[model samples]
Target: MKAMILAAGLGTRLRPLTLDRPKPLVDVHGRPLIEYNLLLLRRYGIVDVIINLHHQGDALRAALGSGDTLGVRIVYSPEDPLLDTGGAIKNAASLLGDDDFLVLNGDTIIDLPLDALLAAHRARRAAATLVLRHDPEQQRYGLVEIDGEERIRRFLGRPAEVETALVPYMFAGVHVLSSRVLDYMPDPGTTFSITRATYPAMLAADEGLYGFPFAGFWRVIDTAADLARANAILEERPPLHFL
Candidate 1:
C-alpha cells in the first residue's frame, strides 16, 4: 500500500522555526519531524510514499532525495497555490492509483498501530477510517462521533444526527481512505477539505466511515510549546517499537 504525507501547510503558528523551513522539517529529536513518519511507514512495510509539498517545497526534496537511505521511495506533489486535505489528495490521485491509501499529518507525531488500522479498515469495509483518540481537548480539536459498531455517525457535528450515548473522540490526523472518496470532492483543482466538505456530503449519502480508537502516544507540533512537550516526552520514554 502507498501512503501520502500531508506536509503542505504554511505552519503560521510555528513562526520563526517555520520561517526557516517547512513544518515537516522542524527538528524533533535528531531527525526531521517527517523522518519519523517515514520510518514508521517503512517499519510497517509501506515503502512507497507521496509527500505533498507547498511550504518550503525545495527543502523537503533537498533533505531526503530519492529516499534510498531511508528505505522508501518518495513521490512529491507540489502545490503552487496550496490545496487543502481533500484537494491535495485529489491532485495526487494519479500517484495513489485505485487502491485505498493512507494519509498522515506530516507535522504531528503518533505511534499508530498501522497494521491494526489497516486490518480494521478492511474488515469494516469503510469508505474511510479515521484514527480517533480520547482527549480532554477533543472538542477543541473537533468532535467525531462513532457508533457502538465503530462506524463514524457524525463528523465535526454535521447532518444533524441524533445524540447517542457513544463517546466522541478527536481526529488523530491519520486515516485510510478509499480512492472513491475523491469522487466526493468538488470540481477538479478546487481547494477544499476532506473533513469539512467531502466528509459531510459522504455522511449524508450514507457512505461507510469508521474510526479506530487509539490510546497511545500522539502529539502535534504546531507551536513551540507543543514541540517542547514532545521533546520532553521523547527524552523520558523513547518509542523503541517504532523504526
Candidate 2:
C-alpha cells in the first residue's frame, strides 16, 4: 500500500520552534513528529510513501533522507509556495497511483487501527473515509457533521441547514482516499484546502464520503502546550507498540 504525509505546512502556530524548522521536524517526545506517522505507516505494511515539503523543505529532506532508516521508499513533492492539503495531495497524484491511499497529518500522533480503517473504506467503497474522533472542542476545531449511517454530511459549516441531529466529530487528520477523489481537486498549482473545497463539493454531490469514529489516543502537536502535553502523555503511557 501507499501513503502520503502532509508535511508542507508553515507551522506558524508552533512559533520559534518552527521558525527554525518545519512542523514535521518539530520534536515530540524526543523524536521528529513526522517520524511517528512514518512508523505507523510501516506497521500497516505500507512501504511506499510521498511527503510534501515546504517551509524549511531542505531541512525536512536532510532529516528524513530517502526514508531508508524507516523502511519506506519516500519521494518528495516540493511546494514553492506551500499548497494546502488539497493541493498538496493533487501535486503528488502521479506517485499516489490510481488506487486508494492513506494521508496523515505530519504533526499528529495517533495510534488507531489503520488496518480496520482500510477494511471499512474498502467495504464501503467510499470516495474518502476520514478518521474522526469525539472531541468536546470539535466545533472549535471545525467539526465534521456525520449522520447515523457514518456518512459525512458537512464539514465546518456547510448546507447551512440542520435536518437531522448531526453528531459533532473532529477530523483526526488521518484519512483513506480513493484516487478518484483527486477528480475533485482544484486546478493544478493552485492553493486549496480539502476541508474547505473538496469535501464540501463531494458531500453536495452525495458522493460516498464516510467517517470512521476512533476512540483511541490522538494528539496534534501544534503549539508549545500541545507538545508538552504530548510528552507528558507519552511519559505516563509509553507508546511501545506504536513506536
TM-score (C-alpha, index-matched) for candidate 2: 0.94
Instruction: Write down the lDDT that model 1 would get.
Output: 0.88
User: lDDT value for candidate 2?
Assistant: 0.87
The lDDT values for all models are: 0.88, 0.87
Mark the 10 consecutive residues where model 2 has the least summed lDDT.
Answer: 157-166
Residue range 34-61, candidate 2, lDDT tens digits: 9999988898789799999989999999
Candidate 2: list runs displaced more than 4 Å.
157-164
Candidate number achieving the greatest lDDT relative to the actual structure: 1
Provide the TM-score for each candidate, comma-separated.
Answer: 0.95, 0.94
Q: List the residue pairs that clash in candidate 2.
A: none
